[model samples]
Target: MSTRQEEATWTTLETFDVEVSSPSNRLYRNGRQQVEVTVKLRARNEDGRIVPLSEEQKRSVRLIDYNSGEVLPDIPASGTVATGWGTTSVRNEYEFFPGARDGMPGQIGPAEGYTFVVRYVQTVDAAPKRIGAQVRRDAQTVFKTNADNVQKSIEAVPERLPSFDERATSVEHGWESQRVVGDENDWDLRTVDYYFCGLSINGNRVKLREFTVRPASMFQWESTNPASEIFSFTGFGTPGSSMAQYNVPAAFSDRRHNPISMPSDGRGIVVLIRSNGIAQSSAGNVHKGACDVDARDEFGTDHPLRVSFKSSSNRNELVLTRR
Candidate 1:
């Protein structure tokens, strides 16, 4: 007969916040964001101590743009070693902020203006193998007894009898990504980022780039997921009129208002659920935001298309381009 053992179950306790601040702020951005989490043990040894073993375990975290599903590289696991920290607050701080370090590998600054959802996963060992034994066409499959002087005979079509057993073995670990959302909460840092984009301002436009860990379907809409579009026009007025262009939906909800920031050259607009918020935060330093007063503009409101603008403005037109 063959026997099998039960698999180990690793439980995730909790995660840290996705901190967002500028380089000017005390906050600093490293090449890779660090995340500290708490994990609990499932079983212990004979002496009641936690069993520990080292193996090639895969630990990964993903940071997804809540509006556009774009992944950021704030906490990519490629260059850093995945190590486990003992129960302590010092080891529980994960960094999602973008910054520069002397020997770092990633860019610095916020991934544009949009926020994202995070997911973390780890792969642990599983149950043991199952074994079985079978006896087919046996005179006595269940309990064999010395046959009487005469050999016993039966016409019944003998069935294959089977038995099972289990054996315990070594354990290993791995990880996966899972979305974390609640009825009320702006921050959900469950996943880690793979890369980050630096901030750049060209003329009157600003662009930011980042890496995402999930697809578009996950974090592009819904209330609490606010969307913003910021643009600026330089000095001097347009002879007749000017316009703004984007790679997003054309129409904005009535609740949305375009609020120009200081210098009056910049215009900030907020879009509601009417538009998918996915790509809104991925605008990199090179993002192109030029106002084309002559070209016919098409906002992606009609369908799933890029956003373009041609709004009439008295101030000098500006372009915000990102790659």
Candidate 2:
């Protein structure tokens, strides 16, 4: 008896708000540049209506970059795309491929696309110029430039990270939602999810990479009566084979039985990697790539904290603080 082959039937579940975010395409040099665009998606029903997404339906969001009347590669096909979400929306990251290596004229350029769920990506390049004067023998030379002229690669929009005082914004709130909870020895964590969209550069013409669903942060947490606490946290793991990589330094500024308090209290310590050699002025702040935890007790001693609990996989890496 011959067995019959079964044809797979695809179904539509739901659709909702989708958006793409990326830095402007104002490059300064003529080399390869990578700028990430985040794609966020919501669940929909068969009628293409908004609905709550079940845990199983959680996936990545697709993205595309339309430039000069042409479509870039690594864009999504059909189906429900995967994405990462904070308490409010999905936070995805897309990288632009290489092109001009040089800069674009200090002005806006055209780039747009759509999400698989019928949500769209409306994007434009905005480059603001800078002005300065150089002292000369007889007269002063004035220079007018912008981020586009300062660097040959695409720079992150909102060049500055969210300030501690700017806690009212969605990004800052998302960070708060993911704050660690519980004792340092035994911890619990919440992570921000992001959907991978696409990669492209400011002046480039080709697409380099593609991705879908991923967690914004990988860690553990716990909760208390008044508020929650973060006992341990590790940065997002690197892709198996990709152009992007983040290394957390083994050494830190402070290390001891550091207690992480809630959002309102400004007593918790923070851990991050800082290449610029600058310290943040605010209190009760934590940054992964830029600032590591300032571990210390009431007495103020220097020690290297160790990871008491660790669980990592292809998707995430976690490190718990020692008490």
Candidate 1 structure lDDT: 0.21
Q: RMSDs, each prediction?
A: 26.1, 24.3
For 1-323, candidate 1 gives per-residue lDDT tens digits of 11111112211111112322122111111212222222211223355433221121112223322223233323223432233111111221333223332422123223321112223211111221111111111222221111221132211111111111111122111111111122233223221111111122222122211111111111122222234333321111111213211232222222122221211121221111122323334423222333222111010000011212223331111122221
Candidate 1 weakest ten by summed lDDT? 295-304
Candidate number achieving the greatest lDDT relative to the actual structure: 2
**Measured by C-alpha RMSD in angstroms, how accurate is candidate 1?**
26.1
Tell me each candidate's TM-score: 0.17, 0.17
The clash number for model 1 is 74
lDDT by residue for model 2 (1-323), tens: 11111101112222122122234323211111223333222323355544433222232222222111112223234211222111112222333222242333222222211222222221211222111111111113111112332332211221111211122122110111222433333322222211121111232222222211122212222322113333333322111222222232233223211222221221221221112212222213443221222222111111223321233221222232322
